[model samples]
Target: MNHHAPLSPAAELHANVSVPFERAFAMPKSVYTSPEFLALEQSHVFAQDWLCAGRAESLPDPGDYLTMEIAGEPVVVLRDRDGAIRAMSNVCRHRMSTLLQGRGKVRAITCPYHAWTYNLDGSLRGAPAMTLNEGFCKEALGLPAIRCAVWQGWIMVTLNPEAPAPAEALAEVTDLIAPFDMTGYRETFRESFRWATNWKVLAENFMESYHLPMCHAGTIGGASKLEEMVCPTGGAGFNYHWILKNDSVPLALAHPSNTTLEGDDRRKTWLLAIYPSLLITLTPGYFWYLSLTPDGPGHVQVLFGGGMSEDWLADPAAEAHLASVRALLDDVNVEDKGCTEKVYRGLCSGLAQPGPLSHLERPNFEFAQYLARRIPA
Candidate 1:
């Protein structure tokens, strides 16, 4: 009997830099395992680069405030009485107590630690014990503001109070999905789940389709072929676009005012990944928004939300479809996270070293390279 080749559960590491351009793409596994690297990313990457925080629809009017943590720094986003959305440090200027405990709306944030109050706009408004500190100046003690920008109805905040507008960096990403009426779509359902793998592993997993037929068979196997998907990397290694097949016939109606698209343009499904973190997927008439946020080196939280036009929200059946989509996708994500976490554990083992990247996993390789190049050599 002829002997069969032994099977291996592994991927090839790319060493050639030729055909894909001069820069051979690769990211070291340590980028995810080093504490110093994570801190630098917080101050340099997450703090300086735009981090998508909340949705525009959430800030409906003045006094509406939402709180979230950015690179471990707590921040509060709110629309002031002037109707302007602003991101402010959640830390009260006085006594250093955090201004907002969690997410919600409030007329004004009053620190429970000392009863110091701040206007929704982040200005110091009142102090019950102003006389207690003769030198305390309310104007000088106002909460500091952060750089805030909005694109495609999503809010992005940067900690560098004077960082340049993210419009230029995020503009192209916005236009890529402009054909769809996104703002008209509200995040009818929202969720956050913890993944057991390195953030980069999850990111890499998302950046390519090589494993779709193998890894996603349970969820995306029906009308999709991983071989048919596309990954064209550009934008300083920070942006990449790819397509996926969807089984649903409802999302095919996305032909907008471009006018050329008609009722017949529904044969294929397209998915685009806006680098660093954002996946815009189209299925039938449904638009899915997937956000990948890093919690720690091997721990990440996936944010799943968005889809449907406001008109769809008005329909009673909308909730059912949204719920169904979330449930299906959520199940698939759980499976992926478990697999990636195992990969991370293997990487830390002294028994093995890093390997190659397949031509099919180019997107994944490109992502690893991007991370490698960004961190200090």
Candidate 2:
């Protein structure tokens, strides 16, 4: 008898990541379940790319801020005294304590451990006992800064200084999304949940509509015909698709603010998956996004938020209208969560392999190509 070592599932799936769209197979189970691959994605894919932290509207006033992590490095995104948005390492310069846990309006970022304080601009403002140390100049110490950009009201940060600006990278996407007037939309709701799936799995899942008729049957899936979905081949930065809604349907069938949009644009929905981790869905009346972050090989954290267009927010029955929309969105999310969780479980069972890709899953194909180009074989 002879003994042989088995090939790792992740190694087996590496070839599928770059297969042509028409001939592409589903992502390999190892891609979702391997710690090694997850580590690579964190370093090469996320750390080097722009990531969405949250909506700028959430931090309306100076000193308002939010905290998030990229490639496992903690970061704080805030508006400084001069009202400019900035991003800096959340780790305290003195003892490495995380400066902030969540969102709040703060006059200055002060470490909970030693009360070492930093100005809104990230300059060191106070150090409790550091004056006693020789040559410890507060002027010379501040939280390490990361590149930050505000694009269409979303706060974006990148660990790599040389990466493309968010505005420049999203210039085409901005034009495609401009008619909806996202800058005028006010973020009204936010919710977060942890999923037992790889970040890429969730990203690919949200980017496709082929599963809608089956997976979201009871909520938004049945409202549109399968034949009406059209996915556009996007360029380097992102990919999108249109799902035309029936005029008689209840949700987003007829938005009062859609008067400015032309025939199909007014009646359909745009689903865009920005490279790396931002997933956006824009309709005539409202838009929502998910900023995805990987926790580890086995989990991902999703920061989900949405807004109503200024016009829709001004309707006399806005409260009741939002209530209905929220209910539908909540249900639809539950459906997605259930499906992705099941897929992850199946991938972990050691019997998973790549399956044929559907024409409707073109965005997933492009995303696979994006990852293949970045991650080493």
Candidate 3:
């Protein structure tokens, strides 16, 4: 079942559990700027969670693979000669070097360090400088491999030794979309942008809807009403759900309805930020999944992908919807970047105190709780 455990006593205590209408949160500035805390988070949060790395559809054929980084570990996902998708370290096990620099077809992963080669399935295929049988057994010298699994065309990966199997951990991300039958949808647009700010700042910014009226004023605010927007929270923390005004999508699309959407159409559009890093949006004409990857404490790369029918993939849809999404994103990003930098600087002013959280800011409160749980004790 898709669910979230209740907040712990300490978590509830740190963030006042009573207020239902306040926007203030008391997250420590250190969590945003401390060098020690960021390193601990890499092991506790990024390396341990089941993350959506890339789409399985992108690597559907044999020898096809994408060079990517999981948490901070360089890795590759490839369809082997036998047509099975496998996850393996993109680093050569012999001398510990990068195998592939970028995404492409490869009969074998050859290391630039010493010309060591590995099959996509991670078998030690060739080593020019060393003897095979006289040295390490090819069977025993395969590249290190990690577990990966696909659901609804999304490829999720993990580096944790004890992380639940991909299929089991992702059952929740899948069940949430069961009503939409996403297999029929195909990726139409994919774009990524690197921002000069902390990734957690972006996550905290996206976990709620309070900024829509102010930050998103030019785009979504220009086209619709935020006051009537219905946002409810779910997921591990307080993720959001809402239907906007004037959301007119085709009935044949993912959300099929003959009725035209007016003010506050509850089923018109759905926006959710899944725990940790995934941002998912389901609209009348399309659906998009975004992953927020932390390059370092002060840097992040936002990966965005759009989905639609075979027909829409060939052409664009209503300009207003796409424009609103992009503009709202830009506005929110600008607002968030300012705070991230401010917090990055503020943490140094000796105001780094653990403050209480208001319940209306439940998502941010839970975010602090999540960081607390993930950081090593």
How well does each candidate superpose onto the true structure, as a TM-score?
0.84, 0.95, 0.78
lDDT of 1 by residue, 1-377 (tens): 64775321111122222235334444545566666667766765666666766577767888888777778888988888888888989997777888776457888899989889988777788988677877988788788888887776778787876655666765665565554545666765666677777677777766666766767777765555656656665554255545544446333344232353344333344465555666666543566666766787778877767666655556666677667767777777776776788888886777756556666566666654454444444
lDDT by residue for model 2 (77-102), tens: 99888888999999998879899988
Please tell me which model should have the higher TM-score, number 1 or number 2. 2
Q: Which residue segments of model 1 deviate by more than 4 Å?
A: 1-26, 161-164, 244-246, 252-270, 282-284, 310-316
Q: Arrange candidates by TM-score, highest first: which order? A: 2, 1, 3
Name model 3 segments beyond 4 Å from true: 1-24, 170-173, 230-233, 248-267, 309-360
Q: Between which residue pairs do clashes occur in model 3?
A: none
- Greater lDDT among 2 and 3 belongs to 2
Count of clashing residue pairs in every prediction: 12, 0, 0
Tell me the RMSD of model 1 versus the true structure.
Answer: 6.8
Backbone clash pairs for candidate 2 read none
TM-score of 3: 0.78
The true-structure Cα RMSD of candidate 3 reads 6.6
